[model samples]
Target: MPAITVSRRQALLGTATVAAAAALSGLPPSRTLARAPFAAAQAPYYYRFAHGKMQATVVSDGILPLGDPSGTFLGTSKEEIGKMLTDNFLSTASVVLEQNILVLNTGDRLVLFDTGMGSSQLFGPTPGKMLANLKAAGIDPKDIDAVVATHAHCDHVWGIMSDDGSRNFPNAQIYISQADFDYWTDEAKLAIKEPAFMNAFIAGARKNLLPNRDRLVFVKDGQEFLPGIQAISAPGHTVGHTIYMITSDGKTLAAIGDLTHHQVLLLEKPRIEFAFDTDPKQSANTRVRILDMLAANRIPLIAYHFPWPGVGHVAKQGDGFRYYPTPLQMVLDQKG
Candidate 1:
């Protein structure tokens, strides 16, 4: 793949039209397209439904830097990985970390799954667009009835709090798995061999959840978060990473949070676990189970890290899986 260096000015111009549209419609400034030149191309947000009335929107918060891929996935050969990246029109060895947040509008209530990294230095200017996107979709944070977290990972949980350390969604009740909450908050777990990263996670949890403890609800596996959203326990990514099932009308969508970081490498090679997974073996097993279920049931998926507008269907391609993105443009055109 050729190296594409987008200029900052071009980036800003590309995003300006979207920002202008949001402004004309009285949306928040954050959702305004970045004025920065195009350092990298931006992906569009998308929406679809499970059942019929339940609406799911994929709002992209932003992308994170791609670090080295060495030793990340199990049995992943650098040469093979490079070939796969090239095949996907991406540069070998450089993995762009895409951050996605899902909004499910279940008629009576609006729920968001996994907040994105909120206005942090790590996310640059594109950070904290979830709220803006929500507004663009005619959703008010105050209108959100609940916020469900897959795990306590920084990217997944940080958006729960604003830059000034306040709950972003003032009216929403926060829900997280009991296992994930205990693991990140446990001092013993924080003092694991890799204390540094654990400490950072601990700090983030304190900053995001400690003060609002009363409003936060700890969920158990198999519990129903809403009429159509059921919590599915699929641990190993963290202590309690979860996959939320939204079954409505006649279709189903699984909001699988951080089950796998890289779609191509992870989906195509289900057994190869990333280094970030707490228990690679268990994570791999969970991925395999979810992939098998998705293929068997022919259900759509909303992944936190699969390319932007991360709503897609998974298909069994021989021994592996393939992602079939539900293109936002096509959906929008049909809606029109």
Candidate 2:
């Protein structure tokens, strides 16, 4: 056949005519297709990185959407703090904090640091997702050899029990600082008519820890929770809010649980007091001291409440501290 090609002008005119006909006939555009089904709401919440010979996995329990920081945050004006949040591209009206739970595989054993808010509704809907994330990370509750708690804060310890009040980690030993266990479980302290939340804390602790008391091993500062995990006393957030320093092959990473909540607000202003801290002065001192050590030694840390997978380093920035998140596979020269 001879060439039969439509000119550009003719093609454009034809497309316009078809569109006009469709529109006039109340029909949809030819390019418009039916709606697609909603895909999965979220992917698995887990991140894995190497800490020397050990493999560290961050299983997100989820986020806690907090109210305005003006009431909970101290040592700064609400206006300035709001500006700080804005500067960081975070929400000014509210802040969302991650509940990062760390799990380490040390060749011979699996260690979990902090069981997140189990089934508690105290913090709203976002939490209590730790178990699901853990499974998504290919770790079973029965495979966990030990559960080391930094503190007995509800967010950190409530996951020890199943909803039926049975031990969640059937084969694991539960480890926590004696000071915190005593402080939270004391009947006299619990009877002080504090906030209703404190009561919830006591009830949760009793429900979670007391059943596993036989398997509970109370640790003190400087004690080795495991062969490679040493507890560092970082008190004041709680009486015994100890930080777990994991070491192997001369490499060290610390799980600084609840040491600082917001990287910008708390880390940039380490002296800022959190209302949840038992002793605000002591908490601030511990924060500054630990941050100084981490910065000076160039050590990596996993903060429980920083952004997800909160693995990062603290550095001294003009008399204040800054959080430098360690990117995956980043290597630091020892001679640097």
Number of the predicted model whose lDDT against the real structure is largest:
2
In angstroms, how far off is 330's CA in candidate 1?
4.8
Compose the digit string of candidate 2's lDDT tens values, residues 1-336: 123355766788898998998899889767565799999677679988877788889999898877888878887798889887888898888878899999999989999999999988887888999989988889899999999999999999999999986778999999999999998887666675665577778878887888887999988788886999999999989999999999988999989998898899997778888878889999999999988898999999999999877998889987679888877553422121
Consecutive 10-residue window with the lowest summed lDDT within model 1: 327-336
- Local accuracy of candidate 1 as per-residue lDDT tens digits, 168-279: 8899899998788877767655566573466777777767877778898888788886788899999888888988998877667888888878778888888876877878
> Quick one: RMSD of model 2?
6.6
- RMSD after CA superposition, every candidate: 11.7, 6.6
Steric clashes per prediction: 11, 0
Candidates in order have lDDT scores of 0.78, 0.87
Top candidate on TM-score is 2
